[model samples]
Target: MHPNKLRAFWAARQGLLECDTHLSPETVLEQTGWARSVGGVGPYLTLFTRAGLTRPAIDRAVAQLQIHELPSARGCTYVVPRSDFALALRCSQGFGDAAEVQTAKKHLGVTDAELDRLGRNVLDALAGGALDPAALKDRLGDLVRNLGPEGKKRGVTTTLPLVLGSLQTAGEIRRQPIGGRLDQQRYAYARWADSPLPEFTLDAAAADVELARHFFRWSGPASLAHFQAFSGLGVKASKAAVAPLGLLPVSADSPLLALPEDLDALRAFVPPETPVYRLVASVDALLLLRRDLALLLDPADVPRVQQIGGLQDLPSHAIVDRGRLVGLWEYDPEREDIAWTSFVRPDAALRAEVERTAAMIREHLGDARSFSLDSPESRKPRIAALRAG
Candidate 1:
């Protein structure tokens, strides 16, 4: 495949160019794959840009338990649809807790026995109803032990998070943004009345295979390296996980693999001739899932990529045309306008897209954060850099 054509193909597959009237947030997730939610607006923008889902609609879905953020593959939180919650939580099982547990044990003198006791306390506390972190901590009193200086140095701070994380991984409780919004990090804990882990029949290995299927279908023609990176399944497990999928290569010597059912469609797919502009979050699956931005760039843009930050990341939220990344964007809250710089010359279509997305952000989202710490003040440098371009 021609390089640009390949990029556009990825764009189409990501639901950027081929927008659809997906009836619900979960339906969009089912089609476009899970939206990465890093205490940011990526999930909302992803649903809006791809499925035309509004903020009110998405909030309603969350309020009604249609979709939610869950720790899944690689132990990263993704805004998952209701249908995949069990699969997501199942895949997350041992993966999410290993590192955190190890760090707590080594640095804060944490023990499995200590966590077991705290876990029970946490469950009992939430049995009555949900509680935000402060309230939960206050309710637990000294039961949620403070680790003092050593813990503070290592960023562990307290035993509360350790138990909370362990319990969440074990599916005893769920973390919800205080007001059920995806953008902020303040979370409340609630007992999952119908916890999926209890009913999830798939064991660890089977769950890994299921997640691998999702990875391929969402970002197919993706390399095995991509799957390994996303799953964090290490060498042998990652290979074993995808081995059952019967994935095929794009060419005789191609590194990329796709599901068997998708080969014909991949071959027949065509890049859009007219400019199809899309403004999306930095962590949108189109880039983050593959984590190989260099592959998405035109050869001419290589030097510019180096000048900015290189292939692994973008300096700001992406401005994509068809499937190819053409520019970078940031929302200027003061002006209530989108500030962007493009690899291609600024065109009417691109500006129009900026306006449309800006309008949506102003009226509905209020802001588009790259991650939890992102703010208007921090965005100035990137916006200035874009304006300078």
Candidate 2:
């Protein structure tokens, strides 16, 4: 498929272009295959942008267990709908737990037996009521007090987090919100009481098939490599998973894969003639769809977009125009404004679009005073120069 057509198809599929606001926040999350929230606020911002959801609504859904946060695909935490939790949890098995355990062992000198004992104790501690990290640690003080010199050297506080993660991975406990804010990361531990996790007997191959199906349904016109990259499933496993789906190619020459049902719609997709702007969150799904920076960013601007230390660092969240990333933006809490910088020179029309998008962002954030392209740092004279012109 043509790049623009593919981009439009992706935009539409991800609910960026035409959102179904009638659907509940839970439905939107499930349909989109879960929203990444490792940054704490990503999932809430994603729903606001894509589903037209408000922070209050999101908080309600989460509090009611209509949706939940869990470590899923690639072992990153995601806010997934409660109904799809089992499938997401099942698909994430054996992905990153071993490495985490090894790191804990090396740094904290925690052994498997210790972890097992701690896991059981943690369940008992939470059996009566939910407890936040600090409270849980206080309750488990006697249990984890003897993590040894290594734990002290690495900071003994790390032991509880490790144990909590272990129990979560084992599906013995889950995270519960501790505050009213949707963006708040404060969580208490609770038993996974909504429903029991699926047993291993539920056909691994079938689970993989369902996982691939859900991914492509929301993120189609993608490649097997994209699926592998996003889901962290191995090449052999990814191929086997997608094999039964009978996904269709976007074009004879393109490596992109699409669901057979979507082929006609994708072929007919047209990129909008007018500029379409969206303030996407850092590590948003659309940006994460492909790692090739050139596809989303202007080649010349790539160097400017990399994080301060290196290219491996996360790119700042972006403002996208017609599927092309045109600028970087972030919410500066102290200033209560959306700070931004455009990489490309804006035409009259694009400038108007940017202004309108900035207004929308400010209103959505409620307390945001304004949007500014000027850098907060005095040393960055170049950014100020861009703002002046």
Cα-based TM-score, every candidate? 0.97, 0.83
lDDT of 1 by residue, 112-176 (tens): 89888888888999999999889989988888888899888877888888788778877789998
Worst 10 residues of 2 by lDDT: 367-376
> Could you give candidate 2's per-residue lDDT for residues 31-139 as a string of tens digits?
6668876534567667866766766788789888888888777676778887777776776666666566676677766788887787888889999988998888788
Task: Report how far residue 257 has shifted in candidate 2, in Å.
Answer: 1.6
| Candidate 1 Cα outliers beyond 4 Å, as residue runs | none
Which stretches in model 2 have alpha-carbon errors above 4 Å?
Answer: 103-109, 145-158, 196-201, 297-314, 343-389
lDDT of 2: 0.69
lDDT computed for candidate 1? 0.86
